[model samples]
Target: MPVNTDPKLIAGNSNIPLADAIAKRMSMHRGQAVKPIDTRVERFNDGEIFVEVFENVRGEDMFIIQSTSNPANDNLMELLIMTDALRRSSAQRITAVIPYFGYARQDRRTKARTPISAKLVANLIAEAGVERVLTMDLHAAQIQGFFDLPVDNLYASPIFALDILHHFQDMEDVMVVSPDVGGVARARELAQRIKAPLSIVDKRREKAGEVAEMTVIGNVTGKRCIIVDDICDTAGTLCKAAEVLMDAGATEVHSYITHGVLSGPAVDRITNSVMKSLVITDSIEPTAAVQQCKNIRIVPTAPMFAQAILNIAGGMSVSSLFDNETLEPIYESLYPNS
Candidate 1:
């Protein structure tokens, strides 16, 4: 039998809305409605995961859209099991599209006897028979080397730059800031795109999830500062960074984070902090508190994901999607109303 080349999308319970949005955007690309495979990822009473794929995916190009976000273990297991099911079912190729890769921060062992969980997770994915992996804005770029298979790491800078351009009319006074020194490259890329200056927050971390002290490295006086980073967990770092910027005489502070892992007190901090707005992507499903937050906004990544999926399926260059000229058309196609 000839191998089925049509792309088939399957999603776990992590972010169904994002999966559906991607399907819709892909449908627009194909000029026909492309729906996700009828798969059910349910749990047993004892907290075991059970995944059932109703559609025939045999010999098809299968893409599983699942983010290893909150409840990271369960979501990761779901993706692995789903990949196993597809491989066993004789799918031609299986790609795991994880928007938010969990345990990415543990890419290295900072101390003795600590495990590099990111590499371990990469090994698990490879062992599960996944042929390819597509993820976005990894906490550390080095994590890509851990994967044995082809891993397409997409960037959110294109999306974020577009949003920043539309939101802020005066680009001269806008400054792109890296919440920490490590993120300076990410922030610099966005700064170049918008023709803005870049600044780094000099910070020292005593331990995980805690900051010892922070100081501004550049003049933020009378400037509209936008902090760019990959993750925002407890909001401690971001909130403190905002405060430091404010203390440095910043006219206003804002943030464009890729993953909004707003855990305990994150929403509260952002709500009461000096930041003007917080923009994040729909990599993880937002909780009710996040949705109700006044200053937080979510931008859809479905269009970019849809374009990437199309390129992969068509054997096109994925990197071409990053060019401003290339991204403008994609942004227009998916978000015509905007």
Candidate 2:
């Protein structure tokens, strides 16, 4: 289904590079009029966020492309203020296109007295007048249930599978590994696509930033292992998992992750770890430390993201793009003979 409404795309301070890429994709498909909206966001002297949408979006379908990544609180507030501004301007419908949903790790309270901050963020966005949300690879799938509005949860599996296929041919010995038992379902999906065996890392998390002991649950000895997960923050678990995988006789250890929230000591840990390399999507803009890391490589997600925005604008199925069997045909349509 082709789209009817012209998109008035807007971007916040969170991920400008990704926003620009999505806007450019829309422009190429729609025309010059579908350009990115001019907007300014800044902080006042009192440390308050100020947002101004310079264009007239009254009755226009507005999509704000922002990721709630690092500086989680600031970025989250910026998206909220931007949504409020568009609502006040009479935009037809507001869609929060968040690539990395921060605070999503707190979806459920493991303890009795802690707050479910993920649900709180959902409520805050709904109260901010956001009518719809489009995000990719949420920390937990149930976060969609928290929203009162339409939420589209996209995945990176298609891209990751395509990447794996392009790099490897005889995948007989390749293994898709889950860093923890909690991620086994995700690992199973990837393992099925590549027709590779699966492995699980059973580890006990004694605290937030510490991993007590990790044990490999499958036969990874002398085989290449690809550890998969949603987010790699601080690199504690990833680093430790790599160490154990190597100690268990795995020839090489690599990781494929959606969001790289490489906070304090993450880069340092990755650089000194036994992992061969880490491949992360460009959901969160690459930082200077990430760019300088010798063991880290980034796979561009702009093309897929651009196609997704175009699909949503056209009222088409965005989830189909994430299908294991549907990605390559679409990729060939976008960039043939590549």
Candidate 3:
């Protein structure tokens, strides 16, 4: 059953800008100077975390928005402590709204003996008293099975579809491409939505830290390609794929990735890659380097999330927001200001 009460939005340091954007959409965010809830999450000199909720949350439905992105351990602990605090304070319900779920790529164990870190993260969140979780585009769809609580796995395909249509109205020579064989389904859906052909990059991963060699699976010659993937960790796969496609006579190569974990030499690699642009969502906040790169663009995700939260509070079906093959009408309904 959906809770009809207005939910309280609490934020952590993981992605302050994203959190503020979500709150602002709900008309709950006051400028930095004044806020309804005073969240005090601090760390000791030795790197220990402590959290305290100053405002009274007794019997309130609290929604904590925190992305378990880079610095995963620290941000995760902060969420745990804050959940504990809210539970101890007798909050009616606690929902952990994690945008970019870290450790999600470690969902399975391929080696003889290894830890399934994604399952462990699910355990930690459940153990912390989180009643529900709302996350976007998990690396592996099976990660949802690890969670005991109700999980709403939102798709970023709708977001990407709208942006692609707005920029590339003439789709005659456009092709949607998967960076690697693993992401064919994701890329296929976007291609189908935009009425474009689909292509795959067959990659050979020799070893860690080595750029993969790829071969195009479909005809991309003379076509403007849109490479799609769930994540862009170091940008090696995308950069290499872009070069391969362009070398094969591709006119332009653009990318749409959900979680931009632009770590290490990602920004530098993307800057030098043959890709025309790299569009990412605000699931994970962009770094200064990512911001400065002319090829990197961030699509605001607050309005999308804000509408999802509103639907949840009103007992409306949230999936209805983007449950169709065509997504232009959905985006317009949710973000008319755009």
What's model 2's lDDT at 106? Answer: 98
* Candidate 3 residue lDDT tens string, 1-338: 44745778888889999988887766732233323378899999999998888899988878889999989999999989999999999888888999999999889987779899999999999999999898999989899899988888888988887788777868899999998787888888888888899999898887755655778898889999999998899988889889999988899999999999999999999999899999999899888999899999888777677777766766667787675433344467543432
lDDT of 2 at 214: 91
Clashing pairs in 3: none
**Best-fitting candidate, measured by lDDT?**
1
TM-score of every prediction relative to native: 0.97, 0.95, 0.93
| Model 1 C-alpha lDDT versus the unseen true structure | 0.92
lDDT of 1 at 192: 95
Write the residue-wise lDDT of candidate 2 on 1-338 in tens digits: 22345667899988898888777766766666455688899999998999998889888778888899888899999999999999999888888999999999999999999999999999999999998898888999999999988999888777788877776666777899999999998889888888899999999988988988898998899889999999999999999999899989898898999999999999999999999899998899989999999999887676677777777777888877877556676566533432
Model 3 residue 57 lDDT score: 92
**lDDT (CA) for every model shown?**
0.92, 0.86, 0.85
- Candidate 1 lDDT, tens digit per residue, 1-338? 44344789999999999999999999988899999999888999999888889999878999999999989999999999999999999899998999999999999999999999999999999999998898999999999999989999999999998888887878888999999888999999999999999999999999888999999999999999999999999999999999999999999999999999999999999999999999999999999999999999999899889988888877788898788788887887544433
Model 2, runs deviating above 4 Å: 1-4, 31-34, 329-338
Q: What is the Å distance of residue 283 in model 1 from its true position?
A: 0.6
* Runs off by more than 4 Å, candidate 1: 1-5, 333-338
Higher-TM-score candidate of 1 and 2: 1
